[model samples]
Target: MKLYYMPGACSLSPHIVLRELGLPFELERVDTKSGKTERGADFRALNPKGYVPVLQLDDGRTLTEGPAIVQYLADLAPEARLAPPNGSFERAQLQAWLNYVTSELHKSVGSLFNPSMPAEWRQATQQAIGARFDYLSSRLAGGGFLTGPRFTVADAYLFVVLSWTSHVGLDLARWPALKAFVDRVAARPAVQAALRAEGLA
Candidate 1:
């Protein structure tokens, strides 16, 4: 397996998942901005989306999309409890959260990352994202993680998305619970490993 990633992007989610699962895979850094690889090969040859978090299987096939990739990697190591078993209520809840993050939070952040976005669309997205963050802040109150009791894939997505707050000058100070959530997740050994792997720690 080869995980293509950009430093501090959504790619970190799958990277953290792989580390948590103790999966043995190779990491291939992708410079998404340049559309090239560390080896100077055209990255478009691997993923036409020109995005990171593309996991190339040993068989030459590659998986795109962060949510899908992390879930696939989690299913490969169920005993690690990275996610709930299929067909369970927890699994449904997890999927719901994943979908919410992907469609709502993730896409909103991605829209803002685009320098070519329409001014009105960008402003609306910023307001929408702020409301979502406040909702998350309330839900996370007095809890250690997103699900309130255990670590799940949602927390990974949440952490990665919330990490973007700094870039937008969105103050996290009011979202004490969410801020604490970031601190708690960062203190985890697996998350630390993920950070160190990316030279963040």
Candidate 2:
């Protein structure tokens, strides 16, 4: 498998998962602005959506979207238990967390990256994100992963999204539990390997 990624981007989630699963894969750095991969291949040809975190499988099939990619990778190595078994209540809960992180937290935090966004819109977005963070803080205050005591793909996704706080001038310190969550995930060997590989460590 080959994972196309942009350093420190959401792609880092699956990148970390792949490492955690101890799966053999190759990395291709994507220059998002140029729509080109490190090897000079047209990224649009691989994923016309023109984003990072495109996973090319061994048979040459490709997977897009961070949530889907991470879950697919996790299922491939269930013994690692990065995600719950499919069709189970726990799996549904994990899916809920993934959806919340992507649709709510990721989108809100990511919107702040647009330099052309109006000040009013940015303020509103930040306020909206703060509310979401408050809920997450309360849920995580018990001191375990998002779904339970064990870390799952949802935790990997949330960690990547929360890591974006500093880049957007949103301080995680306001949400102590979320801040500690980031610290804990960051200390994981697989996450550390992914970070260094992406030049983010």
Candidate 3:
């Protein structure tokens, strides 16, 4: 499998997942701005969407989207317990949280990074993200992680978003649980490995 990614992007989620699963996969660095892979091939030809985190499976299938790819990889190692059993209520619950992280928090963070976005739209996006952060803050007030207790894929997504606080100027000091959560996830060996591989550790 060849995973196309840009380090420290949302692609980091799948990078971390693959590392955690101990999967035998090679990394294909994507220069997102150039729309080209490291080998000088046009990324657009590989993925029309022209995005990172496109996992070219060994079976010759490519998977995109952060949540979908993470869930698929987690299922590959169910005993890793990154996800609950596929058919269980717990699994649905995890999926629900995963969807929230993907649609709500993940995409909203994009607006902050794009200066080309309209000011009003960016402000509105920031406000919406702020509300969601508050919601997560309260939910995490009880401690542990996003879904409470063990670290699930939801925590992984949240970690990716929260780490962007430095880039977006989002104040982490306001959310105690969130700040603590970032620290905890950063300390994980797999996460550190991902960071080191990206040269950001």
Candidate 4:
């Protein structure tokens, strides 16, 4: 399998999962801005959305979207317990958290990066995101991970989203639980390896 990624992007979530599962895979860098891979292949041909985190399977089929890719990869190695068993309540809860991070947190943080975003929208998003952070802080207060004692794909996705706080000038220190959660996730060897591989360490 091969993963097309831009350094420090959402792709880092699946990249970390791959390492956690000890899966042997290849990595190809993508220039999302130009819609080209390092080899000069058109990224839009692989993923019409024109983004990073595109995974090509051995059979030549492809997968896009960070949440889907990470879940698929996690299922590949269930013994790793990167996600809960399929169809279980824990699994559903994991999906719930994933959806929250993707829709509620990820999109809001991403919008702040747009220089031309309207002031009203930016302020609203920041306020909304802050509330979400507060919610997560409470959820994490008793946590080992998002779903339970074990780390899951949801944590991986959330970690990537939270990592964007610095880029948007949001100080995580306001929420001690979240600040500690970031420290905890960053301490994982798989995450560290992914960070170093992406030149983000």
Best-matching candidate per TM-score: 2
* Worst lDDT 10-window in candidate 1: 144-153
lDDT of 1 by residue, 136-167 (tens): 87888988776658887778888888887778
Residue 200 of candidate 2: its Cα lDDT? 92
Instruction: Give the number of the best model, judged by lDDT.
Output: 2
Question: What local lDDT score does residue 67 receive in model 1, on the 0 to 100 scale?
Answer: 86
- Model 2 lDDT tens row, 1-201: 999999989999999999999999999999989999989999999999999889999999999999999999999999999999999999999999999999999889998899999999999999999999999999999888998899999999999999999999899888999999999999999999999999998
**TM-score between candidate 2 and the true structure:** 0.99
Model 1 scores what on Cα lDDT?
A: 0.86
C-alpha local distance difference test of each model: 0.86, 0.94, 0.87, 0.91
After superposition, which runs of candidate 3 have C-alpha atoms over 4 Å from their true positions?
Answer: none
By how many angstroms RMSD does model 2 differ from the true structure? 0.6
